[model samples]
Target: MLRVLTVALVVTALVSPPAAGQPPRPQAVTSLLAGMTLEQKVGQLFVTYVNGQRADEEHPDNVRDFGVATPAEIVAKYRPGGVIYFDNDLHDNIDSPRQIAGLSRGLQRASKIPLAISTDQEMGLVTRIGPPVTQFPGNMALGAGRSTTDAEQAATITARELRALGVNQDFAPDADVNSNPANPVIGVRSYSGDPKLAAEFTAAQVRGYQQRFLTWSGVAATAKHFPGHGDTATDSHTSLPVVDRTVEQWREMDAPPFRAAIAAGVDSIMTAHILMPRIDPSGEPATLSKPVIDLLRGELGYDGVVITDALDMAGVRQKHPDARIPVLALKAGVDQLLMPPKLGEAITAVVDAVKSGELTERRIDQSVLRVLRMKFLRGILTSPPVDPDKADAAVGTPENLAAARTITDRTTTAVRNDGGVLPRRPKAALVTGWGENSTRTLAKLLGGKALPTGATPTPEQITGAVEAAGAADLVVVLTSGLSGSPEQQALVDRLVATGRPVVGVAVRNPYDVAYTSVPVWLATYSYGAGALESVAKVITGEIGPKGLLPVAVPGPTPYPLGHGLTW
Candidate 1:
């Protein structure tokens, strides 16, 4: 039985290993480290950002206002092992993949070692790469569709596109189980509430990236926010979430997907900023807890790179001195320090820690060796820098878009169609929640009035919308985060009270259905233009709905997990 295997995994995870098994360092990596200074070795542990725009240019609205550094400047001074790309880097010129490739190449050329060019391209809502890159449905949709092959295909395309754009590391396929429907951050980013299904999907996604090479140079996939960010209701971006599960409960519910990811030979596991009190009684988040990280390495036997989540997150930042958090994380067994608040301060702190006997040089070498070994294995050490001329042609091709469409089409699920009110090209009114109308394809499809009822609509607004939509054949309420927003629930309740047939479209969160009694309901796990358009097509019977429900909706007669209907 699956439970037996899961139990065995937990038992193994609980027993700490004597030491993390270090992979054989490549000769180049060995020679490079042998000749490196302590500061250079410490620099190899950081993966910071680079500005695509001019250093003199004002910080873009989307980018963090952290101290800016040119890729070349970072290499010369900070000597970071890697550089992470963000929307600010390419949002201005996303259509030009060659330019992105040029950025990656320039950064690599400036580095002493081949930098691990990385991004947070989790495909759907979390994608760092902008439009034209295939925006496939996210993890919740993949879980709803119940197809491992589709999940693998999506990830492969993601890897293919990212590698084409000269990014080799993708912090994606969020392995968290969405056990708590109200979880603020992990909501639809997670695959399923069921650990077994999430684990299978996680493994499939890992295989997609690791097994399928976009370039001969390949890509590395990271299974992220480890020890599960699912059960907690807090967002680690703003505060530290305490996961109160006992060790056994975590092994059963939270650890399976990670175990499966490790089994699939994942390239990296990013630590969560959340604290697991049961796993380690010491009042420390997993990011700085030796017992927790040791459990992952010693018991789980994950020898691959152990990356930390963004250090700028409040969960860790508010807990430690800004300059010292990176050092503590490195001491806690993190190999890659991602997005520290101050790049120079973090590198300097680590160097000072070593000199002050707070951290040993041997300990630093252990992490640096692991980092070097990964770079070597990924072929970044020997592979030529990404060719700018070939990047645009390879990335965002029609073939890749078609693959993304195929995945999206299969993932749009119909959760409810009471009295068969769907699959009709009805005169429908479009009512939206926050950021719901990035594309007006749904409104354009219905040839109806577009109304913003607000994220939490006023009763007057809802009633007015109901009156406004009186002439329409159907009322389509596009709701987001309704499960957590009572005001949104009131808006949906009033709309459903209208005489017209009401179709509840859970725009971003599938659990939005639990808040309303709409005659018909549908769930689009992503707010991407393609995903929104796919929902419109599925509703109009242009395409059939194939996705199953990845999470349960609470009610007296609740829609169970995997409950999906097709006309």
Candidate 2:
């Protein structure tokens, strides 16, 4: 049987609701709070991660980094209502999508309550699937376009792939509308600068993509950064950033996409750790803010589940250094306390809080009820049947991968070019220390040698590389903008200053291209194997540049959005 534990537990309650010839199975669901033991109800609100497996460890999957127990043991021990999967949690045996399905079924079987398995496979940003997988540029890349069709398409494929592997819920299609490119963390993770466009795209993504499980009976979608976390410049992993926007400004800028997502029936909302004094003056994170949670539940009319960002993030850690957060989060209306790093302690803390009247049992029961209701609606309690192989039509097939390649290819941008920089007259070339891409491999493909430099190249590196060309042919610099680091800008400026025919290509975010005046440049939005191969083919002049500037490049923002300049 293709059984996941959460569904199994739910099915245990549902299997005998009516006769086999039932007209419609009644929509009766257990109030996980109503009929369950206190311990079981409290367990319903906690989510743990289990990437490692050991015999004696206390916490499951060692989300606390203690490596105490394996993922299976964690589920069996705590019976958490949800589980979060990091890249490390994947079993190595999952070479194809099918194997991943089997592994997921096995994990789900270990749980007693219906478990919602969530993975942060943001489609293109940090995919853990195998080769032949098409890479969609992260949310930022898709945001540059006029329509959200691309994002919807990419999300559809993502849902299909994940569902094939038995992943029920995905924390993706980030609804954060980022207005600033200088945002150190959420730059590439977001969709766009325009709030309305981001909302429209996110709506399409959730509506079009969230239908995967509904349409295919397997995958479900969750839109994230609820109550808005994209506009702030600070990284939530470090400290809680105070979004200085007033309520009116927030409604205008940051609230649209989330509203759109809610309209689209998103299964869950992940709270941001950032502080919004305007929304909650207590200086607590949105995760532990009753005002903010109330805003989502009441004002926004959100009737779905509410989950907190990882309790281990510094945003929560700094405020409560004692690891007693899951209790406070429950009191604040959070349904799931994700990856607390201290499961038993977190559970005990909640129990203690209820005992002392610091946290009420009724409050915890509210979230538990919501969780159980959802499972009941999905028919997991009585009928926990899954066809892990059925998603084969959607996941990893050539059709889906081809679509991934098409969008990825569309994002490769040309940031700059002065005096017709392409089609170099001479054949000589000097390539070195561009970015962390396969520049040398491409150079070799074009029958040239790639060299390593002793000192990090200065404006002199490009000049030296160009000058060393000695009128040979072309000097191409490949640089990667992992986080759009300043060192990246320095490298490009040095290369462009060389006054050679510099074609600087950013293998990440297109916004990183505006910093340099490189005579020629491109942004290939992703660094996957397919992305690298495509960029390499373009560099060797084997293929004409078919990509357009997905976003506005500095200076010669020559091509308008989606403009493809043909030679």
Top model by lDDT, which number?
1
Q: TM-score: which candidate is best?
A: 1
Q: TM-score for every candidate vs. truth? A: 0.90, 0.83
Q: Write the per-residue lDDT of candidate 2 for residues 1-567, one digit (tens) a residue.
A: 333444455545553544432212223344334567778888888777665322222443255443344566767778788776655533222355554555566566676665776677775555656554445667766664344778778777776566566666777778887665556567567776667777887887776556532144434566778778877878888877778778788888888888988887676788888888887788888888898888788888887778888888888776774457887777787787887867788887888888899877777777776776555433334344345576455566788778876776555555455787764433666665544346666466556556533224455554555456555466666665523455445655665666667666666666655554666766666655566655555666545566554444433333455554434
Error of 1 at 490 (Å): 2.9
Q: Which stretches of candidate 1 lie over 4 Å from their true place?
A: 1-28, 54-69, 88-95, 212-217, 427-439
Please give the distance, in angstroms, between residue 214's alpha carbon in candidate 1 and its true position after superposition: 11
lDDT over C-alpha atoms for residue 197 of model 1: 98
Q: Candidate 2, which ten residues in sequence have the lowest lDDT sum?
A: 20-29
**RMSD to true structure for each model, in Å:** 7.8, 5.1
lDDT score, candidate 2, position 221: 60
Give the Å shift of residue 256 in candidate 2.
1.1
